[model samples]
Target: MSSPLFTSVHVGGRQATHRVVMAPMTRARSTQPGDVPNAMNARYYSQRASAALIVTEATQVSPQGKGYSFTPGIYSPEQIAGWRLVTEAVHAEGGRIFAQLWHVGRMSHADFHNGDLPVAPSAVAFEGKIWKVDPATGKGEMVDCPTPRALDRDEIRDIVSDFRRAARNAIDAGFDGVEIHGANGYLVDQFLRTTSNVRTDEYGGSRENRLRFLKELVCEVAAEVGANRTAIRLAPFLTARGMACPDILPTILEAVEFLEAQQVAYVHLVEADWDDAPQFTEEFRRQVRARFRGTIIVAGNYDVERANWVLQHGYADLVAFGRPFVANPDLPARLAQGLPIADFDPATLFGGQDHGYTDYSPMQQAA
Candidate 1:
């Protein structure tokens, strides 16, 4: 019998031929000035169309949602047209893709905001940094993040509207569905932790209050795009970027319950994959499985052996490979046939031309 990893699965009411998914990664190669996707981006995605599901890089929903330089946006007409090329390219290859809507919140630098402070749930200091480019040198580097201002009640509502609008734009651009970026110490993750969000208002303090922003954002996006087409990514064990919260696990369970109620498509769980990172308990996995009946995507440092292990045990419906997909476009086929997986060039991973992007060929061409 074949490995369970090769088995077909249903995700968001759509049939995926296999269980290997391409996790979203920040490439920072969008067209400058307008921060739009382009033909090169389309080619890069099309080359990796063999994956069961492709979650595009974290795309900012609005200008205020951007953090790093050169990341793509979905709020403008040109951006929508640019993304259309990507969707068309992937669809032409018979592959499914979802746009990951993102908001960086306080994880931003003032250079992108015209000297204004990045907004968050509270003005708390975040020991975080963002990738920025020096205009004079035209090279990107990690820069420290300054303390951000708290978002007003009305401003919070506006951000939620931005997410809903972004979802609509994704569909208009021919995307199969949309996934909200709620992990990796971004805007939504900031609101979920007490260390980052200490507000006494309706959006902070208690676990329920802290979940209010996520609930509203998810509800609004699902309303614009059907709940069956809406998805979210969450990280429960993430402790970096000043985001360690004692009550986070229970809070995430509550959020999972709400997602089940909304009938959302899937929940993408990002495990802490760094060296010495905390382990994701199997008990928590069982709890989440009991709460949500939809698809569960688990992403971390996973290889073929680990991927099949999770599938055989029913811990996840799909496994997402991040760096592996970068170097091996035909990752599913390579794994299926036991072909050699190539190593990616770290220097050219982001903000570059096709050297390390579309230049990576399939096994036939490589051989």
Candidate 2:
């Protein structure tokens, strides 16, 4: 018998060839001035088309949603055309792809906002940093994030609209579906935690109220794109960047129930990967499985054995590999044939040309 990881599965209303997914990573290699995807971006994604599904790097929904320099966007005509290149390339190679709609919220620098503060659910400061490139030297560096202003009620509504438009744009650009970037302590994650969100209106004060933003955002996106085609990524166990909340687990359980109600395609759970990170209790996994009937994809420091463990035990339907897929484009075939995997160059991981991106050869070429 073959490993269950090699079997086909239904995800986001499409049939994926296998259970190995390509988790989205920030490459910061979009074209300058317009922050648009380019032919090089298309080639990079096409190379990894062997994954069951490819979630493109977090593409900002709006200009203000941008946090890192050179990340692509989906809100403009140029960006949509640029992403079309990527979707076409991936499809031509017989692969499926989804665009990750994102808004950085307070995880941004004023350099992105023209001296204005980044907006969040509350006017709070966290010990967080964002990646930025110095214009003079053109080198990426991590910089401190200043305190951000709270969004007015109307601005919050506007952001929800931004997500909706981005989803529509993704479909227009020929993606199979769209995944909301709700994990990784970004805008959506910020609203879910008490330490980051201190709003006093209907948007906050209670867990239900805190969840209102996410509920609204999901509902609107699902309405624009069919619920069967809409998906979300959530990090229930994340506590980094001043985001530790005592009530977060129960709150995430509540969010899962709402997602089930909405009938969204899948829930991508990002487990803590660092050595000292808290354990994602199997008990919690059981709880989530009971609540949501949709597909569940898990990503962390997963090896072949661990990936099979989750699938065999029914904890997840698919496993996503980030760095592994970067160095090994034909990751599925390599795993199936037991070929040697290559190591990626961390220095060229971000904001670079094809040297460490599309230049990584498949096993046949390497051999």
TM-score of each: 0.99, 0.98
Candidate 2, residue 307: Cα displacement in angstroms equals 0.7
CA lDDT of each prediction against the hidden true structure: 0.94, 0.92
Per-residue lDDT tens digits of candidate 2, residues 90-147? 9999889999999999999999989899989888878898889999999999999989
Q: Residue 213 error for model 2, in Å?
A: 0.8
lDDT of 1 at 283: 94
- What does candidate 1's lDDT look like per residue over 140-168, in tens digits? 89999999999999999999999999999
TM-score of 1: 0.99
Question: Looking at candidate 1, what is the lDDT of residue 259?
Answer: 97
